[model samples]
Target chain A: MSAGDDVAVVGVGIHVFGRHDGVTGLEMGAIAARRALADAGITWQDVDFAAGGSDAAGNADTSVSILGLTGVPFINVKNGCATGGSALTTAHAMLVSGAADLALVVGFDKHPRGAFNPLPEDWGIGSWYGETGLMLTTQFFALKIRRYMEEHGITESTLAKVAAKAFANGARNENAWRRTPLSEQEILSSRMVNHPLTQYMFCSPGEGAVALVLARSRRIRELARVPVYLRSVAFRTRRFGSFEVFSPSIPIESAPSATTEAAAAAFEEAGIGPGDVDVAQIQDTESGAEVMHLAETGLCEHGEQESLIQSGGTELHGRLPINTDGGCLACGEPIGASGLRQVHEVVLQMRGDAGERQVAKHCRVGFTQVYGAPGVSACTVLTV
Target chain B: MTKTRQFRLIDPELIGGTEQVPRLIGSVCAGCGTVTFPRQRSCPRCTSEDVQPRELAIRGELWSWTIQCFAPKAPPYLPGGVEEFEPYGVGYVELPGEVRVEARLTESDPERLRIGMSMELTLIPVPGASDTLTFAFRPVEEDE
Candidate 1:
């Protein structure tokens, strides 16, 4: 995509992420969508199209149904945890293609009651096993952590520091699910969910919704609103069956193709490089994944994440503040909405409206990433 | 009077196809050298409808593994309750034909697992349950 057809994010909104005892997924999406429309100084009638994402099949329909209530045509997208990023990408494409002048993208999910298992009945490789039982998401990431540690000489204590930092940041986010700060001692003392990974090291699965309003750059300028342009949005899946052969212990670095491909495409579109990113929000289902993403996102070199964390480079006052809105570790993962939440934070930081949790100085550009299971990844670079 | 336990609802496809043997289904693209496990009508690599069904090799090596000690937050699946097992190990098994499948490992002990260990696929009954079976990996000794 070229800058000529670039779309700009004019407004963003999100419901506080946490357990909501009474609200359904539809209500959450509607609430965020309304807030986004208001923030953009427009009404629901102004939306030319709508896009949504949800992990729960039921929730996807609910989101689409809610958007229809606004009298706008909508499409539902599902890409596992990357659903939100995928939704935004779809909205951007529609605007750039002239399918719509104004579009809304929303994502939301309600935590499931029990273990999260990939439905094997769905036509996919996961369904082949007649009844081998459900596999927990933690197990897949735990294996990656174990492998990373063995290969990179990383220790559990190092990973705990990331959790601790996220918890501290979470305490500053009024919308975060886990508002309490965790000390290194607390994070270290937490019960183990997977060896080397404790309870606090993982993001909580909660109910949440995020919405964004996007328009063609020309329209944004005409509307007299600060334009947060979508410089580049790229989605790439790993070569099937390559995950196992490629350093499972340090897969993030080994699968440089996915990250680099997305980054190159995005940067090329943005007319910038890694050095130009003032802030970033990377996908980290677990603390270990955050460390790995630091390297994969090019914020630091491989095997240098631990030192980067030790140097406090990712802190709010650090050179390049990351996940300043607490991240999944603190804000909780709403699956479908998590990716959008990352972008929302970046937009807020860029606009200097992040409240108490705001990063020092102004941020002009930021990057967000999200990964889907069975090996799919998406990255988007945004600039104000 | 007869007493019966409530059975969980499961997809019939998972109850084993008519063949009575669990088969890992995937799609191989004729236009490009790409294989998609669990079958796709259109090839992901080449985006061509010229795809055919291919069965994945059941046996593979253990690429990596981990034990789950926490409860998951989704549906149709239950974590080990207070009365059941608290934790279990799962691993990504790399099949001979280059498919990476996730499954429960028969080896519950973490210390016993090695990254490159040889493993074979097997269909076994769910622990403490009957009539329902799931796929898992069984360590293969050199002699076997």
Candidate 2:
């Protein structure tokens, strides 16, 4: 068995991103699953195991007949917004362990709109802190970036560029939730939800679903479709002294984020550096997020964002195109599906199937990451 | 005079006792000397069981902050209602030789806040909150 021959994301599907009225999250999940099955040139019966992730209730649990009553081992996984990435990690492990020849990973959510107000104890945070109304997800992100800006000299314009790029790319994506392109001024002028985090800069909570079908080398090689192999899947939770969502207080000293830790492990496992990534899809829960994440993912050094973004180096035609499918900025986050949607975009980009927003460079590899509330992160590397 | 009640919204240990200096109470590890606010049971850094509660610095530098323009959801969160909603500043104050604590700010005006500026502990009544004491930070008043 070759080192990279364990399993591949042979097929992928999505139910767009946005409010899907009159449809249950289960229905959206099933629809996306069928699309993924069709894309894989297989059927529900072929799935030997199922892994599901979602933050809301009802849908993901009794997901058996939604795809067909296969009586498979349906393992439900949840890692906040990293739900999809977590599911992929589980499905990949099952395939690598030789536990299943075919595994289906799906993430779908229809959560209540607006910012999340997760309980403290729910994520192991202090109850005294949780009751104080400090649980808004956006403020956590803003606070981290605010400190980063102080140390790194990142200006408000640098943050605006990230949002502008998302809408520009999102305008070309047929499945994007907010296809209306936003100018930097509009994004800057949008109502300030939090200082430096204007309304347009923050992604909304919306509904969507995404799914992936994975298989072994022999099973996937025979298919006519060009295989988008799963190079590595890494997951990491918050470590000590890390400033994260719902954390009321941190130690006197700060530590590297979970994303940084997960990215390091992913790079080691994939046998690739950030430079090897031809395309990427990092979590952009807010405009400043993409900037900080670019540094956290090791794609760039601290304080390099001002020049990197100002130079249009992160644009679709720039040195390193990121979030080509609009990301959460344009798609609005549907927790469970957000991570998988990122992966699906990478799959499309790697396969040379991304129509309007395709990166012109010779794309050999792609990376996607998801960071979520209460300090958790998951990353995946893909190559064909 | 109309009778009124007051209380601390957070833990009592967080407040300064007798001195009225508003020293945040935390825990220090005997093994690695790690300091944590809200007082962790065990040392998160060294996993030391010999951790003890220690009062943190009352004065700090504002590392970062955000002006929350909207009120959060109700039921256990909104000490106040929609009509009472007012924009507020939320920030992390990095204390000398201690941990960074997230807290509400005495001032919400963005113009008055600057990173690295000195801040001192104060108290605020959460809108719609009944008999609760929550702490906040203000630009240290000049020369007392």
Candidate 3:
């Protein structure tokens, strides 16, 4: 009889995104964990189960030495961008099964500068794919968006508008990386890293860390004020015919993206539809992703983004505010931490703790999604 | 008579057929009729191992496209430094009943590319290694 309401996120913590010269990813992760423990009004010694990981950063369990050797059964996750969501999924299952009363989940990563350079053999493709310069993730996004624009009447203007809104929202959130807002015109005119997508539209690989503390039902009623309930968490990989990152080719037939499937499953498990979500934080790996994911997640209809984005419907004060903390576009996507960052932002918005960039409308339910490499996605539905 | 030499392909397993009219080599699933570029041993759709090698259509329509306006890093990438790199076009060409093969386009200008345009496969030397040949597609000339 366990449901999403059975476990609650009592506390959340984040290390400022973007680069930090001397701080290592593990250090940032430990800092975020300590902050979350403090926010939950408890100590690390109180945690019984723990899970965390990073992409390029060191192993997550090594933090036990830094946070006191409490002998907490800690697990490490390394599922690319979905690392955060996977960790949360594990912690949630443990709490729901009565295996643990209190659990902590942390995600963090530190990637070097420039677009991520994934190896061909790593993705099961020949070296020719990368040797010929077709392995860039940016190229895939540009190609997808370019075709989407042609098919759905999405103009380049709408693409720039998405990035403009992201930076504008980032300007208000002090923790965001690209805090300076740029106009749509400026964004469109920025150096073209890929045709139809400018340099400003993409999120660079950066450094950051985020952590959350979960308390089962009984403890939430006793110790927490305004606990955001973890309604449902869903994770999925690409099915055949679905286009994903690092592919030499794709089938002529089309299928729903991993995000689409995961979002649907999440909403169904939570017993909440897309219409009930007042605010959301979707994977804005690029501006086009925000546009495509908006419809893919069922928040809107296909081809509806053309008008919704142009009219400022996705802004902080708009009808349905998206990426309230600027998302991956402005947050710089730390891979492991990006997914948790979305949940962290949603948790803040739901609790009315989001300072200046809070959504204007009263919000009860929040949705977050993270989609990444080789066709993987993780979605969550949270309610206050 | 001029001495003709054969071109060395970047990956012989990918591009096959005569050097003058190269065609992409893909695999077709005998069970479910699924096709994949660069070939695979099993069907991604039905999980059948009865896949056969097949020569794909040399001509198709541009499904989607982009331009690589920056230099990719080395190691996996074989291109030259940023200064020597030239922006190139990349896209997926849909082969009607077959699969969409992602390849480089000879054209670099975005204005010159359009969706659904006729594209024919061609071979060009790998950017850094002049002696190595790789596959690409170029817009089919109307006159031809």
Candidate 4:
């Protein structure tokens, strides 16, 4: 269970991401799965297990059926926005437990048309009900951004700057949903969704699927074509009754227990420290999450996030390149697929396959974090 | 003959239930001494099965608030679907006993909302709706 343990990610693949061009979720999953198997230079017969991640919405069974996976244990996982990371964690557990030598984790989503609905009233009343209206994720984060601005003397322009940087990064990504670079002025001028958050600051909903092939390190060395060893994987949910008290909205006397716990476990397993991360791909559900993560993950101290942003230390050429693939901000959230996509980006960076968006030097260890709604977060540290 | 159906907004109690009232439910671990909301079945702190349910404090200080201006996708529960409406403010309220809950603020006026302002939870009946309740945060009054 220590760092440099057994499992390695030998293959990663993704289907094209965008507004659905008539591709069903199952078809997308199958394509990504096939590509991953091919990338690992293995056949379907070599796979021992298959797992899928998606939110509760839509007909998940239809998509699972479309995968056409036969004669192997099939597991379905749903963890809100963290479905992708959750699925991977499940697959890794299967491999570590000796249930499967080779496990395939796939995530895909075709968001239901129209507005994202709140979890049904039956799921317990959401935190967002008032005479004024229901609070959605974007609006909730926008409020937090406003508070951060008020306290830190930051401005809407600072948020716009983050958007601009993400858009610029996205422009270099061929698979990115939004490929056009945007200026701070243009971002500021975009239509506002919530005060201080314009349309450009948010990610458009997109459809896509991603597949990751995980194997025991022994199998990896023996049969893998291109292997990215998984040095450490850790998942943690927020402590009870504390989600609302965390940073961005409220300054906690203590750091976020979930992120801290996950990071510590990951580092312990990876046999490394925060200083050792060559590249980072922390979750950016909102721009504010990125700032909070910078501090929570021990990448920077509290109150130093603005300095990191202002110095461009988080940009592609910075000492620690963070979110080099434009992140969820520009890549568009494919819901269940986002976690694996983060892994995919890191694999590409580590493999030196990222074209214009590549970091200046080789990246040996890449760290990724993914957070789910209802206060669940997962972090994974990958090393070659 | 079957009668045609009419649309109406219902209170949270009717929409959810009285069991979901009090607006908050969390777990307190007997072993490690921790509390969490939405009520986990097992104690996350000690991994002990011994845990008890507890209701959260209704009053707290506003951590922050924001007004949503866009239409959310699906389950058009909120008003003003495609058409934009006067925005509403949502904020995290830091309750006594170290619990923070995300809730809608009753006061939509941004000027009235300040960080650290005192607020309390209220179960308001949705207008034109019956037997249903929604939670909102109201600026605390001098008297209970």
Candidate 5:
């Protein structure tokens, strides 16, 4: 009667994650949305409600324009990197409230080149802070990962291993950007973008889109051959003391990161624990993030990453494979679209449709999460 | 002695953002005792308007650090020009009992720096940018 009652993801689609030199963000989003509708075996006019968020650079409400001007309620929710998750959550509410039988969730972005240099003033952080040149998103990932490595016994090798695995998994994904299989040593020796995090160890900002078509259980049973149920979905903004993006300072004693909090909430909502998940796709803006998030999601203990990573426990054949489709590590993040991309991978895995890179174990349940600035995170649990 | 005027790129608050012997300006909430760098109009914690400007400790230990190898974009960050730009070290220095400040690290050699080592603030003059002054933290030598 709660989260997973009758809402099901009948279809999902994603644009290849890479540079779309001449294409606009809206164009890329439209392509993915159309693909999703086609997969859902439904026309655009069949959608009763649409939810999504787009980057300011490309009009936020481009979902309607891209999906064709359906007079349905097209609500665009913007919550940083959690935008896609927010879209799914909003659409699910419509089904639960008996407001809509079918819904569409779309997310897309075309990031500016180079590292993200957010105007400090825009986030109320002031220009002097930006002038310090310390607010670069690269540095944020580097600093946090550096601190995490020190606190936890995570070795530089462990970081390299995560990237190596991600790139290897990404190599099997036709939609991934950096599909070249990277060895651990090569990742370790890549150009140092920031200490502890080499260039290969980080996900670059890129253009892409992801969309999901959802329907009530009744409609899904009739239309979809195998409906992937939305087990749980949750989004959380950063609470006080979190060392999130654009923060001037964090409290000495603080709550866990946004991803950690959201993961806990998603698990609780679904009444499922980490052990129940057969596959997972977590945030990996940097290799360290994947490591930290794996532990934060209660998938493993804080200091267990060193041994777990060495045992190849997170590989595709492992008991609980993580980042099966390379995750953000191989497919550079497109912010709004990244969360749904995680969902798409989980859906494909659940449906036993993933080729080559499919997990060795049957994926009955899966998890996906995304985290971003000024401080926000969204997580969802899915199952067949 | 040559005379030169010093300015904080935008705010005057950063110049004295810390208190103690070095004195960095900060804001304190009368209701909740919350202290923040670059003085704000009110307390973020208690939503109290009784927030007043105060000074924060200038000394702290190194919490974490990173090196910015790429040149920041032109507008907000005046890192001279790309050719003139050199990679610099930055870190979050934790002023015990106060706030952890994000500032440029004076030390670039990772070998010489330790996470818990004591750090002291030192103002760095930015060239090309007229009369601009920025801050950095250097590892405090035992002999000093």
Candidate 6:
């Protein structure tokens, strides 16, 4: 492959994540796609390949009825929280293979209030497991973080700090759902959803959409003035003995989480070290997720979060800003859209277009990670 | 005197011992010796078909824990409504030399729960349905 065989994100768009009263998920996706196309200074007919997905929303390809059916090869992806990542991976491969000059990948989702009520049969668990009140993603996160805290000397204050920082950033992001910055005390004292995690600390399942227009390296300069190079994209699933969501039991032996593996692989492929990342967007399903992922993604040491977070190292102006768009914590997690949202935020930050919430550092390299149910993770590295 | 009728477990395949000393039903792989709860037909580690049903240990130490303060949505969660729900303890108890099992704990107060504390397998009424029983792990008393 030539040096110009790589792919880059030329444009991006988003349908403000949170409650959308009358709009369907498909309509949001079509809207985002059109916005991304406009940002790229191109029309839908110019796209040669497309891919997208949503968890509870309709098939991604069905958005064509709204976006105008140009007969694009729109592949549908459904990898839980990694839905957007999987779509990007597919498009990246297609572009690198010389099959497509331009690609449009979108992800959108609309979930009902409260936690996701997934079926036991759908996840290979017996009904008894769910009936016993052990089927909650919140409980799993709480349990994992509880153990991690005990082992790593992480405090409840640190957990609250993560959520507070998310809101602080969200307040600056016009499209974010929870725009009001909350104090760490407020976050800590909020109604406890799961022990050690309060209402303010966990992100609610909500609705939104995001789209990205990618192009072959050679076409990036022509399509956009400041294209964010898609350095690498990696996805991985759980290995045996790893703790994950929806488990009745875990093996005695332990292994690295999917996020750990995917992050390592993405960094390796991008030839970028964790220390070099000026900005990042890791999954923050809850405060604990962000804390553990900070270490798992090799961004920091396992126990360093206590000091890193407490000292404001994760703030937008800090040494390494994380989730500058407020992440799932403030924007709310629209499963399919959440992953793509991370990438979109990185692209905006790299292009100096993140507005009020942009990183203070000169961000040359940015990283994004999305982890989800059934132990799946997707990581990406982007450069200006 | 009238005798009390015995309550049935949530699922027969999950537990397999007398009421006084109930044990979780698990499958041990003949190929890799990996033990899985609720008895799988194949080994998760080696994908071996030579898996056999085995009654897991009844005692273990709490590995990790949390309290579920909100009631889960119904359909998948066959339990009480939001108004009738009470916060409950949830945790993973690691059986010695065996797998760590996730279960509801009898204790909901965080002050009373700690990792590495001794826990014993027991049965509790499935919330909202006292007629049906489900497995749980309760802190072991000092005298017992």
**Candidate 3 docking classification:** high
Mark the regions of model 3 whose C-alpha exceeds 4 Å error after superposition: A1-5, B1-6, B79-83
Per-model TM values vs. the true structure: 0.80, 0.96, 0.98, 0.81, 0.95, 0.98
lDDT of 4 at A339: 85
Per-model CA lDDT versus the true structure: 0.73, 0.84, 0.91, 0.71, 0.82, 0.92
Better of 3 and 5 by DockQ: 3
Q: What is the C-alpha lDDT profile of model 1 across A1-384, one tens digit per residue?
A: 655687888888889998888888778888888888888888778888888888862445455455556556788898878898888888888898988989989999897643355554452433323233343567667877777777776777788888887888889888888888888889989887877688888887778989999988577876545778788788876653234211221211133545556666677766788788889998878898888777766767778877778788888988888888889998888889998998888888888888888898578888988775755667888888
| Tens digit of per-residue lDDT, candidate 5, span A1-384 | 644357889988888998989988888888888889888989899989888886544655665765678688888788777889888889988887889988889899999877776688778876777676766877887788889889988899999999999999999999999999988999998898888889999998888999999998678877754889887788888876778877667667677878889999999988889878899999899998899889888888898988888889999998778898998989988888899999999999999988999899988888998888877888898878
Off by over 4 Å in 4: A1-5, A56-70, A113-115, A126-132, A146-155, A244-257, B1-60, B72-84, B95-101, B109-112, B118-144
- True-structure lDDT of candidate 4: 0.71
lDDT of 4 by residue, A243-263 (tens): 432222222333365776777
Proportion of native contacts in model 5?
0.61
**Per-prediction fnat:** 0.35, 0.69, 0.85, 0.38, 0.61, 0.92
DockQ, all models: 0.23, 0.65, 0.85, 0.26, 0.62, 0.84
lDDT (Cα, tens digit) per residue for candidate 5, span B1-144: 112343543356666633223466778889988787768898766689998888777778999888887788855576573446778888888988877888888788767777888998877655335466667788897667
Better of 2 and 3 by TM-score: 3
Question: Best DockQ goes to which candidate?
Answer: 3
- Off-target runs (Cα >4 Å) in candidate 6 are B1-4, B79-83
Candidate 1's C-alpha runs over 4 A off are: A1-4, A57-71, A126-130, A244-260, B1-62, B70-83, B93-103, B111-125, B130-144
Residue B56 lDDT, candidate 3, scale 0-100: 95
Q: What's chain A's TM-score in each predicted model? A: 0.91, 0.97, 0.98, 0.90, 0.97, 0.99
lDDT of 6 by residue, A1-384 (tens): 367887899989999989999999999999999999999899999999999999999999998898888989999999999999999999999999999999999999999998998888899888877777777899999999999999999999999999999999999998899999999999999999999999999999999999999999678867645888899999999999888998889998999999999999999999999999999999999999999999999999999999999889999999989999999999999999999999999999999999988788899999999999999999999998
Better of 1 and 3 by lDDT: 3
True contacts kept of 4: 0.38
Question: Worst ten-residue run, lDDT, model 2 chain A?
Answer: A124-133
- Which residue pairs overlap in candidate 5's backbone? B16-B24, B16-B25, B17-B24, B17-B25, B18-B23, B18-B24, B18-B25, B19-B24, B19-B56
